[model samples]
Target: MSVLRPHGSAFSGRLGWGRAPAVVVVDLVRAYTDRDGPFGLPDPEPAVAATQLLVDAARADGHPVVWTVVRYAPGLADAGLFVHKVPALACFGEDAPGHWGELTLKPGAGEPVVVKQYASAFFGTTLASTLHGLGVDTLVVAGVSTSGCVRATATDALNYGFRPQVVRQACADRTPALHDSNLADLDAKYADVVDLPEALAHL
Candidate 1:
């Protein structure tokens, strides 16, 4: 009863599952998880919890854990095309309280937190270098907006020579239909869309 279909391509079915795998939790900030925040589209708490579970598992297994959150500079004029396309996210402006929330990790602590500005966590960020430095050959991707940031990050992960394993239940979109549709397409062309439990069990 899995929703994934075989994707025949170079990036298809080539995930090095047993390789040096790491978990990348993208944009699980309070602004996106809060149901009432401007950037909040739907209830992403379940996805956040699922992601935290994966993070815990990865940490226990000695795999690298990386967290990404969107950060903006002071002044709306400095915002990029993403902010222009989705003006609602302006609420995450610099110094906004919305940006201050309980991220996956506490500040000044364990794993490095990569601050991103666009949909893809890899864009203009140290994610690639960090993963490469860690010898990460596979990525366990879990985060919000299945059709947006998650999809973009998975695609780029493949291009960057990392196997992208997207946990289905660990990702959510504004609409359930959108979430399902993106997961299907991702399975068909981008990454292996596996349920969180099944993926963890296999791992």
Candidate 2:
């Protein structure tokens, strides 16, 4: 690997893909996907597009697919401290418009949709146990706001004993600086930051 920035010392290595892998698409709802919405951005589409390929690959390979969505209660009762940090998150309320609370990347009927109140799919959710029940040993993590949800999920995957393969192209943020930095740190310590093709090929 080319060294763009130096790590003080080696603290991590590639966990790689396991035989049983599942794809978890995190927070690609319309609120973040549509340019007219509050958290929307132009560059997130590429990540969404890349993730679509991984989803297809996972389905074809007969692996389970899980999609995570962030939806706050009517009064933002479950949003916790995040609501105070980013008031724009209120736009993801259940009453948000069709193009706001909806998922940009639609899931198949059999695929599971895990609604979350926070960033990481694992945080205060049945995600970890669900994956365990499905015998999913590796997590193919892809989704929006790479610096937030993507990074959080990847880190949590490591802690939860599941190998997280974070597709670099299948993860995005409002700013490239945030996306790049988070992925760099995740690669150095938590997950294997890989290209879309590389991840798909492995799966």
Candidate 3:
């Protein structure tokens, strides 16, 4: 196999030119990131750390920082076909303590949390309006399941007229291959895939 080059070089010189940017943490909740939770993948601690760094930078720069969690009402009626397709999600019902993660924002950090039911935070949520209200034109995205919620959120961010920046190291999937493949696809078609250090440099 050819040596895989870092994604940072791909967006060199195109980094920090947006009007106002925000960091969007999509579905980094316990149900997906915690090892003991039902739909949890492997340890997502590293991804969480990377996301924390981005969150810190965004808050320091006075940029909006939004956190998204997937919440479903009891009985799974609110989850629709998603729960049926992936029965694991049913564990994140409204009353379930496993619905959210241990990593949460500090009080009065940046912005309010956007609770969502779908993979994309922009779908059926106040995320767009929140960003718009914050005057955010660029979106720096981080979260769990690089191939699922992260990808979906990035794609929808692009569609919503926000420049989506997918933090390569701040996202994870069940496997490394899926994470790498989805990052490549997002870089090619949806958003700019960048590493944590490079992203910080841009900011």
Candidate 4:
């Protein structure tokens, strides 16, 4: 804890917004938003509403909007070791009891939806190349389970040389502790943990 005083000391440099920025809505799906679903968050509406704000802002600004959702073949055939790690991931399987794989924030016309089998949207997916092709240098990421997919995406965004801006209000986790801690870590290292207004202003 003593060492935590100087946060981001090594990673303090900000990778500010670039010439082209895009909004990436990740895993805003039923499994997390629907209260009865297996991976549901206690209160997901706030994040959903906040995410919608970013989406609207991006559209109004004529910025690209990309989406990511977890989908697996029946029996988790494509999930690999992730299923072994978090068995709750079964909710995203094709055989899940409900329509958990459905996107809560539906993609607008022509908005590409990246179907992922794991945490990081870029892992084993074409997100990097897609962003490269679209000329997106900054990714405004919003989604659920801040400690998991959100953090993973942000970290990978940096590894792949993209500035990642994570909106606080647009991300939810199983608990406040997890959300806050992960956001702090991301802001100190991987991404900028921003608020809705600040993110909207830049859009």
RMSD of each: 5.2, 4.3, 5.6, 2.8
Off by over 4 Å in 1: 1-16, 100-108
Cα lDDT, model 1, residue 137: 87
- Where model 3 places Cα greater than 4 Å from the true spot, the runs are 1-17, 97-110
On residues 1-203, what C-alpha lDDT tens digit does candidate 1 reach at each position?
A: 87987465545454547568888887776666777766575778788778878887887787888888777777766667888789866766676665543463442347878887888889999999999999988889998778998999999998888889999989988899999999888887778888888667644
Q: Give the best candidate by lDDT.
A: 4
TM-score for each of the candidates: 0.87, 0.92, 0.86, 0.94
lDDT of candidate model 4 versus the reference: 0.92
Q: What's the lDDT for candidate 2?
A: 0.88
Q: Between which residue pairs do clashes occur in model 1?
A: none
Clashing residue pairs in candidate 4 are none
Model 4 worst lDDT window (10 residues): 1-10
lDDT of 2 by residue, 6-40 (tens): 56676667797888999999888887888877988
- What are the runs in model 4 whose C-alpha is more than 4 Å off? 1-8
* lDDT for residue 21 in candidate 3, whole number 0-100: 80
- Tell me how many clashing residue pairs each candidate has: 0, 0, 0, 0
Compare candidates 3 and 4 on lDDT and give the better one. 4
> After best superposition, candidate 3 residue 106: deviation in angstroms?
4.7
**Candidate models: Cα lDDT each:** 0.79, 0.88, 0.80, 0.92
Candidate that beats the other on TM-score, 2 or 3, i.e. the better one: 2
